[model samples]
Target: MATFNKFFSSVFLAVLYASSYGNAAPWPTNAKHGTHRVRTLGKGVQVEAFHPPSSYKTYGAGVDLASSFTSSGIEDKTVSYISSELQVDSAKVTFKSGYTQNGQSFAYAKQVHNGIPVSNAVANVAFKDNKVIAFGHSFVDTSKIAPSTPSVDVNAVIPKTEEVLEGKKNEIEPTLEYHALADGSVALAHVFQVQNDEAGTWYKAFVDAHTGDLISVTDYVADASYKVLPVNKELITDGLELVTDPQNTASSPSGWHSDGKSNTTDTSGNNVVAYKGSVSSTTKQSADNLVFDYTYDTTKAPDVANNVNAARTNAFYLVNSYHDTLYQYGFTEASFNFQNDNFGKGGAGNDRIRISVQDASGTDNADFATPPDGQSGQCRMFIWTATNPKRDGVLENDIPLHEVTHGLTNRMTGGGTGECLQSLEAGGMGEGWSDIVADWFSHSDSADVTDFIMGQYVTNDPAGIRSHPYSTSASTNPLRYSDIAKLDEVHNIGEVRTVHPEMVLFKSLTFFFLPNPL
Candidate 1:
């Protein structure tokens, strides 16, 4: 059976001794258009952002509000690092703390009805070694203001504030850190002092310092509801069967390619035929009203003559693309789960995948199909004659590419690190990358990338579209993530969308970070 591994647990924040980051890593040598800089800050913190110098203001107006809200509730001198698009002019972006109170609003409320100008908090952008770092106070210093002043020119404070912040670059020890995840995202840890009574509780929060998107936060005290369920082979087999039953006329009209094979009648005299080279008798287990099994064969061509090789080739292509193009390398093998229309039917509590294997001799040889099987023998790409062949046509290679790429990407980054969406984005980016790979596989040269809608290879039978629904097709399904309006759309609607996840990921990669991935 395939294995499911867990990485980081869902918890708010992690506390540890603050360590300075080592010298900044070299920038992408291949990409000439991007610049990389590095710097060290303080005893425990390190800050790294990518982009041209002076291109600080990309965060939306919401940045001002979020910063204000984040600062208003806390008393610590908040130091914020903002990210921005690379190459774009930096002077346009302005980081603000909060609105200024009107002149003497408290002492001369009637005299100064219109509030005073609020000082805009600014950050110092700098480059050290070769990576970029943005460091400075996210708020203005109230001490600089004289009490007798009728009203303070919020504008007047901007210059000195920038100078003080800029000077801190030389005073504080540099944190040698780069964002653990990527550029365009901010890394935050609550300021905690051991000897000082003023230090508040230490916590971690990251924002797309550029887009102002709350990428992730680690509090250690926040409630978490996610669980990492083990990979159940039986559930997978059952789920596959639910979506593709050739004999069952009521099954959806999805399609796939298969060698002629059959699942012989079961003990109940019901035909539970297993595909010839696809599954072995021993791996087949009766569970949850469905026959679950593991199937592997070494001889199947990526595209069988009768069944298109697009999906198979696409899967391989995805694996390769992730490694070669995306700089991700992981996972050793990939498997495709083909099943009938009733795949995910059992009570939600009992779903699992059944795994089975068979040899290439067209025999029910489990031993021959195992590791010792036929000098790296052909594994089951089961040609279940009973499967709805129609659905086979719907099998876009991107689905297999996406699934398999999950394995590879997982290995490269240790599966998941901080957030589930990070893991999910690893998967989403894998899917998008796979989709791109599948399109590229068809081209004669590097220029050949297909524009077909994603998930074109999987069945879209709204009722049973789990295995291969592209982000687009899944958009219409009730169980899928479709709405683009909600922030936490997946959790809010109990569904996840294919497009937006990829979009957020793409936006983070393309616009948020600097030193483009050339």
Candidate 2:
């Protein structure tokens, strides 16, 4: 089943950013002081807005509290402005971070009351030319709220937290923290980080210290590893062809197409390694190595295990190669590329892309899962067994590339939070993006690149799995925006909008802006 987690905040921010792009109007030269507008933002909070002169087309609003302000002075001014305008105490708000971007300074703050942090209570302030230009806040009044005191000891809550963890031991000792509940109340809780090594599960549990009841639990190790020895080998894609060894790229077939290294110790390393599925479905068992020889006769089908091994090698090479190719377009570690080992200097340091082949029960599909940021992303390719001769999903390049692109779109958008592409339209856009990227990677001038057929070899179908090939020709597939309301499936809608107009516009801009070699 296809599912996408909803991320409303990220989606709203994306729209706001897109709306403001390339629409900057000239700033007013004669801006005056004491000319500001105030608006109520519900929950007893207000925002004092100061816009540039009427002539400026750029949209920005904030409090005009100061003529000149620095990073150090932003918090004081923010608190002072909010306190005066909203009639709230400055001590109730806490500043989180202040930084400069694109010649504008931005700061984020959170609300706290009675020693308990307010959930979903936030404020953002922006400044330009040393003057406040934009400010927005979601606040809660704490004047009448009472502080919560724990009745139960931390030791008493440990057993309750451990019970919810199913006997998983706490990696870190339980700590006391205040949590804001949904009903606008605060509670003292004991937070525990629990893990089960054999099962490869990690969880964070918050247990109420007053009642010893479990408040919430989040699985950090969201259900989501190899070996190698080889030089050159014959692999099959369209047909049997000698390719570079995946283990060591610098061998006799020196310039082998799929040459890359593998490392089992470092989970976040650049090595493209493949591992066998675990024996138990619930627990994460150690992976066994898939030994590769120099050559294989593709004319005759090999054993199922051997076939999967070859597919794994091909997938590793293709993913790594695409990773390198995309690097030129800013898909680096700083930009949240899905590789454990990042060569770039920016982004979360330990995040990496992990691939698993032929996982559990030999299912007929592949899926990509991206957990919260700073955690490794996972892609699983299953075995296709419906046909007379069973097929390995990894054997085909398009399938693996399609799954990998999910990680790309998830990471690159929404600041690597994996939340930007979760809406209905975004979901359809995601499927289309994957298909386009897969075609781009596997395309050749002589091949039918524009046909938009997927998994033809794996599924053994001439027309492939999709209902129709995505094309611009009206006679072949004339899909328009009006058809969206009638379609209920994401993939179906994606096929109809085969070539997204936004994607076309983006490519055009990229080609125009980037330096031409010629």
Candidate 3:
């Protein structure tokens, strides 16, 4: 996070002085007007008889205060106060808005000079108990600012905007606005809004009206990706495993997971599809997606209501965590994440992940499908029933992580456009990467890498779901590049290259040394 050191120098000195006086000192009070109590702290900066109780104080340049204050007629009161303190004309300060709370209010005003608004010049006055308390200002010196008019017309800048946006320009007239420059000066600029529906891009461009040069641009769309109440039922992650009940199953409260704001119906946020009915085709059907509204029932055994609810909640949490973590590492809107809420900034909407729980078509398999760009990716987690008992694919953490990693690898590796790792050799590499990631999450501790098994809970088999548990020993997996022809399947071939001792060493080195390298 960035700190405003340039704006808080006086406040820091005041804090040090207050610390010397000890805690019992009375709160700092502002001095009387037209007195020597006001002292110059820095160039164009002044401080009055300030004795704040806390270590923090608000101070700024071009800030002045009035002799008296009142809550009623706030605009007139604030304008008069600023005019007297800064020794500027009262007509120059214009009231913007009043931010109010219980017995407190903050009047925000902007400075307009010679019919042109001064960019970044603001005056804020704090009031408590209907009396003046504190204030801060960052006003430009009006005498130093020279008046100017725009030279180029708005129509002349349209072509330049289209060229920069590479998309259709929004059909709106460009507005003339004063923009602040890097040197603390303001200029007349025309702001243009441009968007491209095909590419899911939107931004605002500021063009210098005098020279037709692009001053700056701000992108609007941001990545915001969500919900449920009723009797909350969810799967709680107990270390590496997920358990239905965090406490006693019969008496404990509902443990359903939530992002704290969204509801049970998945259509609103992040749009997870956890359905119970069967589907005729492998593709996701919007109508068949389950809506989580079940009341809590502890006595009920692994039924659809509790099991599917847990699946939906766990899937939403896991996918969102991975998405946000990857975003910090640069997998952002340009990289194509599955989300609908673009945060009013830049993102291709309608790309939410479609997750299907207990897909009826198969009982022992789970998979993720990465469609073309701008389309929703589909993830199907099937039930495991090959053994004497049945197991849900969602209950286990490794299964979902392994499946979702496929989508991440697909979108990130190909520049958000084409398929990645399509050849036989590449397919093996893809599977190996997914397994390695899942293992990282499932491992008991950072140093413990002896166990590299996948889906141990879902499958009772000693080897788990794979042909052989992953190991860093040549005896367990001795296949070399020349042995690629010996195996035809992708998973089998992946084991040959994945379990090599050299690959394990490389993964360990990167995981421990790199900062968010994944």
Candidate 4:
């Protein structure tokens, strides 16, 4: 919602993404200094975000707080709502600023304990229909008493902090603030933001009020950057070119190459370990400069498999790109997404996707094998023999995009058992989800749903593999649910089930495209 305010900004959104997103920590300094942030993304309209403080519980759409408290306006009402939720007085909740859009209202407020402000504690609220529709809270405990006056003064701790920070060229005077501890306890801390000459090292260090120990430190350095292939309408159509780093910080806080355990200077990263082979054989693209610039040679024989290195690079790029894209849509670790080192967010860990490009296993089609959450999902992209020179399914962006969605739908359903798609109907729906994923990814425009085709580039067929392109018109796509009774094949049944959902999806989201940020 570019033009709208924070809460229920534009349209089709009001979706909540809160809790369990890890924050950056000290490297040999493992301290829990995580600050939760919740954001809601509507289509292309506007936005809202929710990240509750490190509390025991978080509430969403269903947990209505309308009957709790009342105020003259949304501003005071938001403050009162948070106060009631936290069992604190309304005076402790102080409103900073907010705005209203399309009749929905939102307000941002900070938590205060006995008048001294609490660090990293805030409430972002949305109001509608005379009730608190939804809100994001990251508040500290006011019930537990902290020191009103600091035993360790701000001035006395600078030299000690300076020793830790090496040499501080510029510094913000330390302020006394209440810091929340991992044990659900509160400690009065002196907060300092200092900058140094060492490669522009800046630190937000917290010192304990009683003993003056370093509570937590966040290095305000730049995130890692990379140049890789991005999602275009179709990579085969647009050709290859490395775009600047497209990492989503909310999902990948440590960057793509690092999974908090170790770092990779190549295609192997936290989300995926990509290579070219029948199995785990090595053909990884190593770029110390973080640029994966493998070129596809169309003039060569067996067009796709001849340049095996480029196939691996292309597959690697698609997996990571689609991983971040799905994360924004709530395929989170808590929701059973594939990722190595889930950063203690939730679900299984060390299950990063393993992709094999130009696989010697088979040809003419690609596939993904998804086990449970903790196990790595295997994606095998085969060469297509439809034309004189075969096409690699890896280079066809939608093909890999389709396969990755198979992992998503398989792991997400039936409590992430990965065996839920055993039934013919269930298996058909799984295939349907894959086609829909690619269809949406390749949707030419907002109104480009009726003519969407999957595997067009790989198959070298204008009509694609399925019986029909996903279309609303009965003439273009005549498949109905009753046809599932006649069809025993999963992909065939999938063609039947896909058309109707695409109609529904096209209706819901007025605009659809993944590459651009929402």
Candidate 5:
């Protein structure tokens, strides 16, 4: 219930935020009075309002909200305030100019009216939950002021020298376009192609046009090739839809496996059983590629509640651990819910899907609630039974990040193995990178290194090992990239030991080595 409340509350706040600017009152001054109130908020700005108090004639004056009090008409109010300059336009007598936010001066016009600047300027500035209120000589209300950022007109010509970003070979060309939403945030959209044996799909990224920062990306799979079947709508929703692979000509179908087949039981008195399924590929993409399509299942009462809480806790850790310098980022949108039939089937035999879930009171021969090696417990991913309705969402589970990292690394950098010794020999750095990200998400680092492994939080028979270090070894050379050597000389301890004494001079020089960002 607490989870439900929090989820709803967040949704409500977001809706309210998207709704009207609730109590944002306008400049709070009459246009006819040249004498108006001036207010200040903190040190960022001051606002002064002016209305032509006595001008019933052709002359009039108005207040300038932006730093640049650039006037628009031909009447003069002849008002002056501390540290402010006014420029007069002869043709438009009411037209006058003042300072711009950029520190350059600009011109504006006002109607003929009273001669003194307004006073008693109370201002209100909204921040996160707190309103900054102040009084100042010049009242500059910028709350409703919008900036005119640089933008290319839609029909503008593309410069021959203007380079466009591209994807790799066999990839669909990106669709780049500038957008001005009817509601007004300028955005840029870029499309990329994604291919599966069944069919090809497209993904899009949205960026802030003015800032060039990625705001979001939407995944799109062609409905003809893939079907989006939803099983749960109450609490969770899956963005990716599941559909049968057109390339698959298989005739046989196995019932989705359930946890009841195994000894696994839910001790929390929740609907304990789970579901699992997979699609077989005609040919393996790679040894490191996702062995099979994904599976999902619903959590029982307490499981639902527990998982939601866990999601928030972990999300907080991830958000704080990185991007601390910037006040907010994508993680602020953390949410928890179940998903079903997320990915479509693949093109032959049994599909291998990874399953994980938290065990309650160790009834299912699962690991202790806490890690054995004093490592912190990580969120786990359990296999979903096909019959089950609720399955974990990527945001709700950390496993997706870890497992997806492995898949991405394998795809991006040629397939690599995760075997301890061999990975140390050739793929150790990659392996460490995975672990670093996994641990880093939990805000764990070398300074706070613990014995937790990638899947330690899974409620599996034996909890995954947590004693793993980023590198298989350690080194005395402070400047060397911490690799397998930092943990131990296991790769070739004897040879390394023997060569160390004879090559002390070379080894000492290693101290000056600095690693390049990979």
Candidate 6:
């Protein structure tokens, strides 16, 4: 961080001089064009976006709005140290929370301007060896921040915003915050999340507090409904049901069916593309008006192949569902999430997931291929021949989700590079995380899936494929860390990790953190 600090101090001083010379030097930053590209917004506030290939460590550095980390470095500092480095009063920066990932520690501080917080501002500094490794911040130059004292009635902003947005439900009540402008100024803004589930509309609205006028709306619904076996209802037992626009608005504003168009008839979309695999031609399952209502056949062997479209539809549905669900937990475009169009958010684009249903590559098992960022992820679902009438792996919701979770753990662990989980133990932990993700997504909040069995539908096994079902009770699942003594392979190694309730729920907390994963 010394290098980044010196770099920052120089820019800070330059901006200090710029303001002294009667110019508005608001967005002071430490970014170079080649290393870290600077983009000027319409408001003239410059933003420094770091491009990877370098780490934010001693020589390698990177930082962003959500999180910060160094590529190669030691340990990390305090709030006072952070305050001094950021050139801000310690009293003004209020830390919301802190957590650690990999070997480095991280803290999230909300910038406060004139007593009120900056709704979209953050001060990011990650340090090691008492030297700042790499840091990023949107902490307002308090001197340039617009005052927070509201001119309009604070209470009146809520109803006006809801009316302007035509929101049926106010998920987050209107709150005051100092909003930064592109022109090196700020606005007293009212921020809130509004929902209209019936109309499939949801977004976070930023309103000008002074005039009670809607300023901006960030879509929180990238959701799309699908008719397929849901998480809890696997094939052979549960029937298909309609999942009304399940994609999240924030993660996918255009929703799942859209790949630049309003709706797609086939099983290809911005988030995932599902089709038959291993054969000469990849046959896609098309729907009428986006209603992918394919019929399933329970007959034996070759006859089961007749209903391959159903499997394709199901695979597409499950993969997209997993993609959107994980996005809410921080697997975003910048974090190397699979998506056709990132809408220029960050990371690589055109790497949407590919799902091969009834794959000819293998049988009785499924797998996922996770390459580096910018490369598309591939998930192949095989046919299970154990039963007299073989089952299509794609028909089972958990099967596709389980495989897709492999991509999730792989891309997220190593900075979206997809090469981090290579060691024996790391590989084993990867498998464990996959199981936990699938297990976590397989049930609802009210359901008791502690003794969860994985791939039961595809494998046609009552006991499930894992060594033991995940359970809280020792008598039921019994496997523990002590069992690691007998396990060398990754799958069994992962089995020992997933049963812990604390670790399982720990994934849920990631929703609060901005994951760099890179």
- Which scores higher on TM-score, 4 or 6? 6
Order of all candidates by lDDT, from best down to worst? 4, 6, 3, 2, 5, 1
Write the residue-wise lDDT of candidate 2 on 115-146 in tens digits: 55543344555566666664555455444343
Instruction: Estimate every model's Cα lDDT from 0 to 1.
Output: 0.22, 0.48, 0.49, 0.60, 0.23, 0.57
How do the residues 219-254 of candidate 3 rate in per-residue lDDT, one tens digit apiece?
332110112211111122232233222222111111
Report lDDT (Cα) of residue 148, candidate 6. Answer: 65
Candidate 1 on 1-518: residue-level lDDT in tens? 01101111000000000000011212223431122212222243333322211112222212222333233211111212232322222232333211111110000000000122111122332222222222221222233332222233323333332232232111222111112223332232111111110111112233322332222322111000001011111111122212112222222122111111323222111111223223332222223433322221213432243223222222122222322232211111111111222223211111011111111322211110111000111122212222333233113333333333332222222111111112221223333333333333333332332223443322343323233332323344233332312322112221232333332132112111111111
Q: Where does candidate 2 stray beyond 4 Å?
A: 1-237, 243-272, 278-305, 444-449, 501-518
Error of 4 at 358 (Å): 0.8
Q: Compute the lDDT of residue 504 as modeled in candidate 1.
A: 19
Single out the weakest 10-residue window by summed lDDT for candidate 4: 41-50
Off by over 4 Å in 4: 1-229, 278-287, 302-306, 448-450, 501-504, 510-518
What does each candidate score in C-alpha RMSD? 24.4, 12.5, 20.3, 17.5, 24.9, 19.8
Model 5 error, position 136 (Å): 53
Q: Flag the better candidate by TM-score, 5 or 6.
A: 6
RMSD of 1: 24.4
After superposition, candidate 5 runs with Cα above 4 Å error: 1-317, 325-432, 440-450, 459-518
Q: Tens digit of lDDT per residue, candidate 6, span 1-518? A: 33323322322222112111111221113212112323332234343322211112221443222233233222223355457666778777766433332234444455676678765454444443334444444555556665567788756776665565566445344677776554556778777766553333454556677877665544322100456787656554778777666667787888777775556667778888887743223334344456666567776463354477666767777777777666654567765689878887766787888777776756888777676567677676778888877877777766677778777666654345453344334455557766766665665652344567877876778887887888767787777665654665668867776665444442222211111111
Deviation (Å) of 63 in candidate 2: 18
